[model samples]
Target: MSDSREVVRGLLRPQFREATPYGAPQLDVAVALNTNENPFELPLEVAEAVAGALREQVPHLNRYPDREFTGLRKALAAYLQAQTGLSLPIESLWAANGSNEVLQHIMMAFGGPGRSALGFVPSYSMHELISVATGTQWIAGRRDEHFDLTAADARAQVQEHDPDIVFLCTPNNPSGTALGVDVIEAVLAASRGIVVVDEAYVEFVRPGTPSALALLGGQPRLIVSRTMSKAFAFAGARLGYLAADPAVIDGLRIVRLPYHLSSLTQAAARAALEHSDALLANVEELKSQRDRIVEGIASLGLTPVPSDANFVLFGGLSDAPATWQALLEHGVLVRDVGIPGHLRVTAGTEAETTAFLNALAAVQR
Candidate 1:
């Protein structure tokens, strides 16, 4: 081997030469709350159903999966209708390995060399990373002091950047604040390109927070991406999807690999969708735990942002990295999102929440 490191560096894309991979720390700890995974495992009933569905597919493994993933799309459409009462046509849906990939496909179609993407800061980091990976220029926008984006502010940024794609994250990551419908409309009006509303955590939004899906009917350029990772507790399955105009679906088809979804994946996702009610039974309880975390953290004299997602982001630490290490020492792990004085923790089972709170309190003292 002739200097493997140098050879790899020479072959790597210039833009990616200095980039780090996107991920939260995966550590073995008594409590792992870094990534916002659903704390509950699949219920026995759903697990059995998934198993049965997968078993049925083994006999047909010789054949490639449905190139269109028709059944999976229909099931997803049905689930969305039941959950959000949005009567979306199956043609309006698209899915891939995860919402990240779904977003990547969007960038492939609409963003690339000489194009650009825009997202507000402290939102989902993946938006920018995916854009850069697609050779699209990334523009960082602004949010208010409290991490909320106003319609006027959003429109101003859109006008200034005029990117080929705009990413708006509802119940935005790291901050956990949901956007208003007005903000979505304003951004749509301001942008001539595809606008992606990332609702990855929408299932946990507080009442009165409407989904951007409501605005999808008239706006052909609008795309709302969601995932089963958080609420359905299906992160390992890696099924992320988006809803948009049928024309947008047609565009995604051009970029996706043929039969991108495996037979097992399609079958398992369909099975899970069939039992969505059962899988989602834990949502309210998880929301309760999330609220408990917010209140508990606030009671400890830390500043916690109001959340519509399953995690809480709190500040007031003397040193966030030191606090993260201290919490890990006490058998708890939370995220230090490179935001000074801030840390994010997922809502776990009640006992886990209590343990985290107690650990945080002890560290504070």
Candidate 2:
């Protein structure tokens, strides 16, 4: 074991020799609330439709999938138009296995040695991980104590770094609060590079919160990424997409492996998009439960960061790690997120939420 470990350390890339793979602890618990996944399974009608589409593709598996995923792109464009009221040309759309891959593709094309990527700290950790993985320099900017980014500070950092790529995560992870369009616009106005806005949880955002999709028009360097995982309950389908200028899409096309999206993935995603209305019907319920978590945790004297996404990040824990372990012993799993005094929980089904709150209450006592 010692010799094998030494060999791996010697052979792997210098940066990755000590890096850990990204994932949550896959644990068996009565109620799991980590990872911010939509708690509902697909509606039966949608499931049947996706299965039927995949069934039709089985016989054609011997051939590669449509390299451009034309049909899926059209479906995605229509869905985004209806959802955002922005009619974008299909040429502006692109997809990969997941939103992380979408980020990776952008990095591959635009970010490399000597190119730098800037993201606000305590935002999405993946923004840093993917940047470093692509050999792009990672620059960590700061956020306010409440996890909010001000337009002035955002512009200042962008100007100071002059990064080749800037990442903005709305309704950011680990904190679950959202950014306004002004913040995004400020970054765009300040920087000379590409701006990638990750909206992985937009469907669950509270009312009146605008999306960056509204800003994509006339901004050739802006890329808005979305996922079917959170709202469409299609995480298992591994489909994530983005909208950008046709030129950005073309650049990503150059770096993408041929036939990168599998035939089954494309079919499943399109079928799921066909039922976007039904699949998203539970957003209200999830939002309600998310609010419940905020109130429930606050009622117990823990300060939950206000959330627009389906998860809540709460602080005021005297010892977050101990509380996390206590909740696990009670069969409820949440994320510690490595923050000093905060833990994050996904808003699950009503019953699951109840279990989490109850477990925390017990731990508190």
Candidate 3:
């Protein structure tokens, strides 16, 4: 018989290694915006609270954490209530090691071999990658030339593929376009399958952008996923949650590992939630920075996509990686999306934005 390792290797799914490259760039720069992370730190009070929680639970490290994460879940539910103006009770909420895992769980529970997952072209690539990993077909519908999805296009795709799941990233990544809620509702009405609205960057958008959570209770098949990674400055903490119907939450729970979140992770996230005010203050600042960065990019005669998120995507940089590398050479790092003639820059602090502009001009020279 063949060796166990050899057998396992042969059995591994072909899609396992077919992932798109995604990770933050590490460069020695005063302002780094390669990833869509908040360019701020957790508030002092929240950090202290997290430390306190960890110290209080230090003696219990030997014991397994509460498998259900009841406390952190409740805090998250409350925070969502205040943030989204949606009455998301703890029963309607579920957490994973991160929102990334939450989406994976969704794919596992609702998508597989015969089923398919649908998303818009040039949206977050992770959605496509996750669908492939689940042995599901990943179908992408191209957006209009303006980088906008039409109501008719959405309905047509939903009717055609009739996917088991549809993933939409609000303030859609790499493009910086925010799909309207009315358009989203139209898609949901046409879709017979589950619809996941990823609101990872919603906080950075202007108020009243109409989050998918607003339509949550009314639509049983709708799930709104959020992460504390961007506006909340908790990327390293790796926390994200979902607000959905009880049935959907139950489905997610089926695929999750017991104690998927460590006690420390739960504590850190809870502390961050407790200081949402401070975190959101930082969000407001990022919005300001986004405006300034967009203006600066426009001043350079580049076309900057109108972004309601923490990052701005611009066209005119035909060779994105080379442009990105040039910026890096000048001690500034930005994201170089694979799309032709496109580049994205996160809005850092005021000084960082200026530095990036200077570096950009220098590269052009």
Candidate 4:
């Protein structure tokens, strides 16, 4: 090893020896569907509102924001109440830069050297990454070949590990499997620690699907996290929030930095929350495109995992990496999520989805 490499390795923790920062390819391509982002832009009125909110904050930028983020918390609570009909108090709401940061706060508060976290594999890799980064032991749990977790299996594993934190990702990442409430309840009954339901893509779920937010009442250990990045079409704003018991929010506050949320982020998110109804209209359109990808890939003879998320995880490639490259050559980019014969693609605009389906078909030929 080079002298610089040797010195850095010796200075860092044992886990830091070979860890790479989390990211996907940032290539310039005609179509980008790697990240499961809402493809729609903000409505004109909402954009103007955000700009106006920021303008109002220019004078107050000299002062630190409310350390408690009181106004933003109220806005978030209102938004959640409108969406879920669960009228949680402002004390039960919390916000951070992204869902990832919200999760990091959870880990810092509840997970550490002696404590551990458990998550089903091929789910959100960040659950594992964040666990390790926080000095928490990460236990990789199991999933069936279809990437689905059953209530019985989940209960068995929870009983086995008895970890301090458990992550259950609904409409799970990469595989796009949506766990039923039965599975969530089973895991909760079995785990003695925190249970986080990552609902970053919950907005795109098919009709009649239930959100875990409904389970938050009388469930102090349960946390339901949501992001503006996906359904709200405010990915660029980097706002993610969660609803839990007020006591759980108290634990996060002990770990969060003072004024961790900026005045600008608070302003932008509150403005966005005011026009949330108009912003979320685009969710129906994206859901339409998501279903189209599922059907299109299935008709092309590939296997698509039934998705309630904005992305589709399809299988049947002999070489997923080669197929990903081939699709890129056809001017489309998709995620090769490290599964042996499967890849994931985000649903974009109508033209973007058509381009992906066409490019995928051409590669198969």
Error of 4 at 105 (Å): 0.3
Residue 85, candidate 2: Cα error in Å is 1.2
lDDT of 1 by residue, 303-364 (tens): 99999999999998889999999999999989989999999999999999999999999999
Per-residue lDDT of candidate 2, residues 276-337 (tens digit): 99999999999999999999999999999999999999999999999999999999999989
TM per candidate comes to: 0.99, 0.99, 0.94, 0.98
Q: Residue 164's C-alpha lDDT in candidate 3?
A: 81
- A best-first ranking of the candidates according to their TM-score comes to 2, 1, 4, 3
- Residue-by-residue lDDT tens digits, candidate 4, 1-365: 69998998889899978888899998899999999878788899999999999999989898999888999989888888887788989998999999999999999999989999999998999999999999999999999999999999999999999999999999899887788999999998999889999999888888787899989888999999889999898888999899999999999999999889999999999999999999999888888898999999999999999999999999999999999999999989899899999999999999999999999999998
Judged by lDDT against the true structure, how good is candidate 3? Answer: 0.85
Clashes of 4: 0
Model 1, position 301, has a per-residue lDDT of: 94
lDDT for 260 in candidate 3 is: 90
The predicted structure with the larger lDDT, 3 or 4, is 4
Estimate, for each residue in 1-365, the C-alpha lDDT of model 3 and write its tens digit.
45886776677776653434556667677678888878887778888987998887888899888888889989988887787667777888888877889999999999999999999988888898788888889998778876788778888888888888888888899877888887788889899899999888888887667788878867989998989888888888899888899989889888888879888888888888888888788878899989998898888878898998899989887677788888888888888777787789999988888899999988876
Tell me the TM-score of model 2: 0.99
